[model samples]
Target chain A: MGAIQGFEIRRSSASLRGSATQLRTLPVVAKYIDTSTCIGCKACEVACQEWNDLPVSQTEQVGTYQTMPSLQASYWNLIQFREVDYQGGVAWLMRKDQCMHCADPGCLAACPAPGAIVQYQNGIVDVDPEKCIGCGLCEPGCPFDVPRYSERTNKMAKCTLCVDRVEVGLEPACVKACPTGCLQFGDKDTLLAYGKHRVTALKEGGFAEAAVYDPPGVGGTSVITVLRHGDHPEWYGLPKDPTVPVAVSLWKRILHPLGFIAMGAALFGTLGHFMTVGPKKPKDTSTTSGGEV
Target chain B: MSDASVPASAHPAAPGPSIMRLAVHREDVAVGDEIVRHRLLSRVIHWVVALFFMVALLTGMPIYSPVFGWMATLFGGLSVCRWLHAWSGIAFSVASAVMVLHWLSDMKLVPHDLKFNLVQYMQFSAAEDPEIGKYNPGQKLFFWTIPLVTLMVLLSGIPLWWPTKFGSTLRQVCIIVHDVGFIMWFVAIVGHVYLGTAAEPGTFRSMTRGTVTKAWARLHHPKWFRDVTGDRKE
Candidate 1:
């Protein structure tokens, strides 16, 4: 009986081994933004909706021209209208909100579903509708909360950085729709240089806090920002100093696989040991009974 | 019952029996001589996790940027790598979820597991720690975190893929959550891989072969060894 069981265990283990030897590679693309020339028209928002064919949101007068309340499953991009006190006059802060398409995107790392969320060769975050189960796990992992889950479709949706357009060598709809040359798309190097020059020109024109917004945090965003004020990134609804959660790192690096291995070994070991060894031999009792005659 | 009446030493001293019957260690629990452990299904499920996880990590790096874009060369080119990375990520998540369901019963934190502060297991002195069992407290902690991290990655990745559809505020939030979660996951998986493949010498074999030597069981799991071997005395 023990031999048969042992052979069976070995046979099963051999058959179960799988080849998980595939290596992954990524693309080289840049997501650039030129905030110097933004007119705060929110044309990018309109363009994004029209091009993507998204439903229009019934936004009320929220005291600001910034209409859409927040990032939702349907609205991918929004131009935030902030009324900032600059020196003496109230300067209208019109910042376009969308995926920064970080050089090191957190969404890609956090996503478990392959193709559900991906980065293109041009460095844009893209999603696969078919693979998404709308588990809503990636929502909390994002430092920027870029991905939104649609209850209707039961899948998360967000910006694709116009990967389709970029693939065909065309500018994104939002960039093209901008009447004021505010949103610019190009290679990362050129965009960085342009952003720096723009910042210099803005600061020279007496906009003191006109600094670039792409800190080394979040592995540096492809979409660079030149804010009108510098009080806080959070004041503009951005995290002050974003860092990946410790729990995620712990799980990715150690807990998940190790746990699986340990559990597998333990379960198998216990079962195997039990089946082969059977029950412990009954304690010796003949001597105590004095059965010898 | 009749066999129980015989003196243990006398039975082994029978003249016909060899003085030293080389003890055959059963692969499963030995009933005289027997062994059993993981069947094929369990081991296959385990390796599925190991394989997809690596693929997910490799493909994911290039998507993160040029710094790791060189990684793309491994998969063919940047374009192919793009779709591959996302798909592999999904595969890893699904496989891991299956693993979670398979091991949920055993991984539940029992009272005995709670007695030992898990932090202590990370220390160098843990090798000698008596409380350590077939699965240490640290291992249990790592097991539980897998589902949590997988869930985070999946949810945050959605808006990133189709940002135009999600609201602006939510997109912003997803960015933050996704980045933060990735860093944490990167660090944790590194440590986990180290422990499973390198930290323990005999462990990888258990996952691969689905069998451990009797000696290994005795050294690592004394109570289990005793119960299996039915040895009550020295």
Candidate 2:
């Protein structure tokens, strides 16, 4: 019933090239996740559900402390728990799972519906429920496997980076509910620097593999994570190096334009043939007349 | 084969089971000098294939690119087009399969047809061969291409319909395959339509009216005209 105010779009799905103009020039924002200080608390998950007005999904324990194996359509934010063999003993490694809001989002590239997926100038990616046709192209488009298709609504759902809250000068609900200062939100550059700083402190304290996980493969993610076992990202259920699928890139960038050209050529070719050659008719018309049975 | 002396009402309706067949299946054999090129069943099958193909194309173009997004409104919306495209594609595939089987015997490429130069034919540089039978090499090529492209689209579309069941790698491959199949099908259909209608004046009547004039048969298919009409004159 209300118009969406604020947030200038930088990129939009299935739009013409150079159409999404960023007129407002908003500062790029990001969520900084320091996995070292996380206590495996599910506050962020609860906050995300409450803020988004999503119904709770019944999750069963599968011989682990995790609430679920992965994030669901209704459950956007998740705290992934992994008991890893760390420093000669087992330690609980916690990582917040959600959409990374990539600088070069694959979901936006693969989406065929106009205005379904959009990226704001503030570096927040949001899905317009009204515009989404639920073709499920975004599922294979995502490098992180983030987008979830809801059978009830026939639409794809994922973390929107709290675009509504960020527009109103408020941090995301997950960051607000995080008791441990592990979750923080601020300017993208500041968080990148702070995440790197934590990596240095963790390395000095004895973890040699402590590094910032801001992969440049997807033009670096909006959510920057500082992991002690950054060298082995798989331990925390994260891809070490993630990029948009080659098929999505090839289809959107090359095949789409080529298909139009090919169709045009076929049409024009037929017209040209018709004009030059004309219709094939009988040389003599006297014997052409006949009665059908 | 009735002559002008026989009254139209004196003849019984063409042999078929249904009432609609009475309209399609005309009086026994060609009257006067008209040659029966296609029967009522073949014409109906051909139209069914065309109907589903157009439905699939109209519904699919919108999803293929945003440039044709306005076409989605004809069916309902993009969401409706999504499922409609798949269902129509299935219908198209089924109709195409029937068409393929119905025309397979006539569409076989003989060794002599190998010399049928496509470029020369399109440019009107070469004349239609007198030895050509029911179908020319070009027509046979288009006929065979239908089933091949239809199979490609159908196989790829199955995975796309249930995308969550397959891996990302497979779905990505299917996307490219589906688009490639679409382009091939579109281009072929364009040429087929042109040749069937405008390019050849009397050809369209064969599919619609189930007959062509003796002169039309002689001009396009000389050998077939001789076989049907017993006219051996040059």
Candidate 3:
């Protein structure tokens, strides 16, 4: 882990949920991967595990060249391979799949444990294994399905967007390991500008669907992917307009506070009855028949 | 007609409880002014269900979200909470089923309950009706709905307990249902507890001692008092 320099935490799951008094001093950082230039090399995936000292998981072949099919406990980054019909011929659409690090992270909002999932000032979502209880609530909380539960330690694990190296003024191990100049790391605004330039170049090269895939539904993400067919994110195993589930929002925003209030109302009602009506005393009619007065 | 024909002032000592009712708790013998209410078996089952509900609630809270992580410490930790909560939930479901079966006969709402104005009853302005029996419509409603809600919670919980067995979409739906069910259950139980204890004094003793005062029965349920005492008119 790199030394965190004046980087304040932005949001934490299950905090007292008050406005943060402390503010961030560091620049908002981002990671941009051009899926159009990716060559399906597994170097980034290898770099991620080696840099983090994460375990190597043995995954079964699931009829796909995309290694392991999906993210796993030990594997934070994966290259997803999909065969798409392009230019009247089949083309292999390879993508680097990892956490999106959403500004409004569903995992953070859906988390029940304090400090389990958190976003730092530099725009990286990370999970604290000690705080993670392995409930897997964050599993469905994620629209991309990134977090994986470790059976060994009973906690959730996910990509930190290489927070360690980036904090120390170094690019993420994946960006450093890319064979082509397909991966870039720097200020988010600069990357977005560069991404637009690349998208224009791609469109001129006869890729009509070339566009940026930084979805704004979840308030955008730190990690942006440049898809050749961005209009159809489903082809890349991505939701078209991904947002946090309504139930998660409703539960946290509405039900959580309302439930406590309702319970309080119940208690107050009972006490009011006691104070107003008191206990109903049973009548005493020793010699009387069953007929009451 | 035998006791009916007797003069109003000439009533003999109340007949002893029926010997056919062999269950000790079912013996409705009026020892002076007190009469048996719930049987011992019924009370035991009710508490067992309550115990398991609390256990499941506390353990499930940790797994539901990290906000309730402190609760995990009450048990061992989240590891122990996981299996403990699941087993307790299953136990609660089974116990609720048993309770529903045991009390089904008493919970059957007859035509008289339709005329039993619940609004007036809640307002504490209801006219006394001799047709009212052991359990009122309100109590019957609680008995019926609790089992249904418990079943709903169990059904929604299956996918969450085993994620790989189901798809991601189904798991998302289950999470919503499970959470909504919990909120509803929490509200219902709070009202039920208040009604059975502080709101209605002497009600708790029925489940604890399996009996109530003759005065309490006569005041709350005159028809039931007459039925047990057999003070019929000729």
| Top-lDDT candidate index | 2
Q: Which runs in model 2 stand beyond 4 Å of their true positions?
A: A1-3, A17-21, A85-88, A286-293, B1-23, B26-30
Residue B31's lDDT within candidate 2 is: 37
A187-262, model 3: which lDDT tens digit per residue? 9989999999999999999888888988998999999989888788888888899998776777777877776677
Least accurate stretch of 10 residues (summed lDDT) in model 3 chain A?
Answer: A284-293
Off by over 4 Å in 3: A1-6, A17-24, A285-293, B1-27, B61-73, B76-82
Tell me the tens digit of each residue's lDDT in model 2 across A1-293.
01144766788889864234644577789999999999978899999999999997999686677898888889999898889887799978989999999999999999999989888777788899899988889988999989988878888899988878887889999999999999999899999888888988999998899988888989988999999988998898889899999999899889878888899999998898888777777767564443311
My TM-score estimates for the predictions, one after another, are 0.51, 0.91, 0.88
* Chain B structural similarity as TM-score, candidate 2: 0.87
Chain A TM-scores, all candidates? 0.79, 0.93, 0.91
- Highest DockQ scorer: 2
**CAPRI class of candidate 2:** medium
lDDT of 1 at A129: 68
iRMS, model 2 (angstroms): 1.1
DockQ score of each predicted structure, in the order shown: 0.03, 0.71, 0.44
Please identify which of the two predictions, 1 or 3, would achieve the higher DockQ against the true structure.
3
